[model samples]
Target: MLLIAVAMTAILLLAAGVVAYVAFPHRGQRMPVVPWLGHAMGKAVNAMPTGTAPQDFYEPQETSAR
Candidate 1:
């Protein structure tokens, strides 16, 4: 019984993570559902930095070449 309960809890947490990812696809490097999880994690989370490029990357930039 204890094993089954633990398995269920793990599955539930995974499901919640999946759902949160789908719901906030553009949130950019956030903990699945618990926002504070990142803050609480502190140095651990920042240890390995990851990010997406800015949305304007493809846009033309003004230049003084001319």
Candidate 2:
């Protein structure tokens, strides 16, 4: 049935993604097993805004000199 075929395809794609995640080097390090996917992921990350640092939430304390 068409539903079975779709399920099988989904399973195969999921397996491929898992294998690529494990086998490939992280993005911006070395070449990945799947270049296009790595490039897409890198672009997506770069497009996002930078995260706030922990220091941003607190004021700096002044030290008293002896």
Candidate 3:
């Protein structure tokens, strides 16, 4: 009984390790948000510092007297 129990425990541990390894390929990659949304957001955000946007993107507010 003791040997059988030990063998079962070792088998379980090996199975758990194999499952962890095989499932690891899908572990950490960030899933893109809404298909091409990731690429679009990255381009727009990255362009801000490089000043690649059109001039009409910003507008001035009119001053008013109280």
What lDDT does each candidate get? 0.68, 0.68, 0.57
lDDT of 2 by residue, 1-66 (tens): 999999999999999866664455343453445577766656666787997788746887789999
Question: Could you give candidate 1's per-residue lDDT for residues 1-66 as a string of tens digits?
Answer: 999999999999989756665555335566656767544444454576799899999999999986
The sequence of per-residue lDDT tens digits that candidate 3 reaches over residues 1-66 is 999999999999989755543444234323343435444444554576654687866888689999
The segments of candidate 1 whose C-alpha lies over 4 angstroms from its true place after superposition are 26-66
* Candidate with better TM-score, 1 vs 2: 2
Residue 39 error, candidate 2, Å: 4.3
- Which window of 10 residues has the lowest lDDT sum in candidate 1? 37-46
TM-score of each: 0.41, 0.46, 0.37
User: Model 2: clashing residue pairs?
Assistant: none
Q: In model 2, which regions exceed 4 Å deviation?
A: 26-29, 39-66
lDDT of 2: 0.68
Candidate 3: where are CA atoms >4 Å away?
A: 25-66
Model 3 is weakest, by summed lDDT over 10 consecutive residues, at 24-33
Q: lDDT of candidate 3?
A: 0.57
- lDDT for residue 31 in candidate 2, whole number 0-100: 42
What does candidate 3 score in Cα RMSD to the true structure?
A: 17.5
TM-score of 3: 0.37
